[model samples]
Target: MFKNKKFECYLLKNRIPGVVLAVLMTVFMLMMAGRFELFNRLDSKTYRTLNEIESISNPYGSDVKITVDRADYLGYDYFVDSERQGSYYICQQDGRYAILLLKSNDDVVLNYTIKGRMISGGSEYSSIIDGITSDMGIAVAQLETRMYPLIISEVDFPRIYYNMMLLVLIVTVLWSVYVIVRCIYEVSCPWKVRSVRDVLGKRADRQTIRDIDSQLRYEMYYDQYGIAITDKYFVCHGMWHTDVVALDNIETFKKLRTSSNIGSGKKKIYKLLMVDVDGVTYEQDFRSEKDINEALSYLSDDKRVKR
Candidate 1:
């Protein structure tokens, strides 16, 4: 099967474009998955606490005094600004802001700003049902390209969304690999038949043959070579050489039937002839039903044929 047929012709005919498309798609999916994963992790519990802190504190005056026994921000230690001057304490090493969480009037108050839309800007009511549907919709959008501009509105900054994205990323990678391998397989397969002129320096006269139904044909297009029969030997001639099989050494013949273009109007039937001659196995495709029957008649006198 031509899993990569669409691009096979393109790839076989033009290598540059094929390789370029392959590389681009691979890179795009990887970057898309990576970026989405980063945003997804930003919605973790630590960042959730940060978002909550920002939501409560941004509305209050910057001069409001706040105190905290202990607070955690990205696993960093810090205190609320005592001077009512600096809104947050910046860690010297990582530069991550540790927002203050304080208990006031029996309600927790968060006093700092949380940066980035992925962390700060979604509604409070979270539902797994909505999240799944959102993931599917975004995954569909990402099938063609990972460009943020094209899918910005449909995108959701959730772990599930990135999980779906990772699935898409895996599928894209596998499909690309399949396409490349299939294309190589198809291209490397031998051509059906070679021209006589290429194998032989001179052009030979066309031969005539009779079918099993006694129909006469002036010209026959044998794939490899024309056939000639004699009382003592069955001769098959190719462009380069002739193959001679003695009648006494002939063995059983097999006819394998195969079909193509299934379920289509232009479907075709074909038969492969496998012959055993003097312990050597030879196989060839029969051009037509009549040709197959005629070829088998020479090899065996029996009316019955193996299917």
Candidate 2:
């Protein structure tokens, strides 16, 4: 049902990579959402007292929820290069005292420590718990002999899952939207007909329209890179741009060769330099000597060519 079969095929070929990437990212985002939901339902709600949490060997990596009835603020606070990451508190319940590491000073003293009991939410044992307690003179000795320490923070496993899912969801949604927009544009205006119309303007006659359409078809069928050479105009297509220069406006055309260092090797680059009557120079790179020579052959009859 498409008018230009070659242009339609080119659009489909170019869009495949983006479409595949959007699909894969969407699938991965869904998988992470499912995992996050499962973890939130199974792990985050189980709460234990300080004694039970301290009894577990290697509690460092495990996610634990604890209930605290009363806490005495230890004057000591933990900082990493002037930024406070945790605050120290002494929790005493049922004749048991354990050092608690909280995210903020307000979290330790607000409402619960001043008034009644509080359920400290899900927390992972801090890797730096030893460093935090080692410098507190008397409290260090008390923690070593009478009680163990627990590190609690606002960040937990379920939050981590939710954050990751949110990030992937944003990226997948943006990319999918971009791909859909591009597909719509390609279907509506194949062969960049809108660009050609803009270049020719409203008063363009039938012959000019036919010439531009013929040149575009020739470029799609035979042009190796994105360069199109016709008797009336020269067209260059780029990732984000399309340059159309009338043949009559050309001033100078020359071949250029240069050497470039690529990684550990040296490579030769070939290009065509065309300067318009207004002194605007357009340089386009070609893949090889043969390709550049073929493009040059199209301009053999033009008097602007510099040997």
Candidate 3:
């Protein structure tokens, strides 16, 4: 199941082995349904055990026989007919006697027909499986004249598995929801919301810049949305940039100044004020993305800005 939203955070990815375990479990399940080579031989005892439930209708009727893929060890070629009864016989590698049948049921929930099959092949294989059924009196391939819907009726009510399944499904859904919600919060909430007044009051800790180095030059590098970090001499216009802006940063102010300057790129430099997009001041003058973040971080935490 794919989600519409991509979990954009940098998380450890597909390289993990968790996916491998999930795949192995899925394959193990398919094999349990007799899909693996080891279980092809369906002896009478096995058939009787499965038949006891009676509620699950093999969408494949008794008429269809399965195409025996392997018959070396199983010792039986098996099949089911139109009426939902099964039959088995020996396998001949020559392929002369191999036949398969399939049937499907119109299950309402899926809006499509679903099917299953019984196989017939391999004489040696058939002998081994049917040999167990010899005294059962009921042919393993004999179709039941009557079919019953799967339901539960105990002294009090129905099978608890049904309720359990519903409960499990609901829990899985809730768990998924919780995971997604947390992921969203983890990704988005740390990016605090800044208001216009918050933006105006925002300032960078100039002390950090001054303390870092004495011979620094300052340049304002900006676009409609971003700033580039370079030592001081202040290029009012940066040549190339591609990113969006966080409103409360000193770098955003720098980009704002750059955009409002006279010439493009290296040609112009000026005193930058707030950027007015649709009559609202949105940006500033500073050097680095770090500076931009400092201002945004301040407003995000400042109760005055929030108010």
Name the top lDDT candidate. 2
Off by over 4 Å in 3: 1-158, 191-307
Candidate 1: the clashing residue pairs are none
User: For this target, which candidate reaches the highest TM-score against the unseen true structure?
Assistant: 2
- Ranking the candidates on TM-score from highest down gives 2, 1, 3
lDDT of 2 by residue, 170-286 (tens): 788788888878866764565444554554445244555445556666643336587777777776655444555566667888999997999888898998888877777777888
Query: lDDT of each structure?
Result: 0.38, 0.60, 0.31
Using alpha carbons, what is the TM-score of model 2?
A: 0.51
TM-score of each: 0.27, 0.51, 0.19
User: What is the alpha-carbon RMSD of candidate 3 to the true structure?
Assistant: 19.4
lDDT of 2 at 29: 76
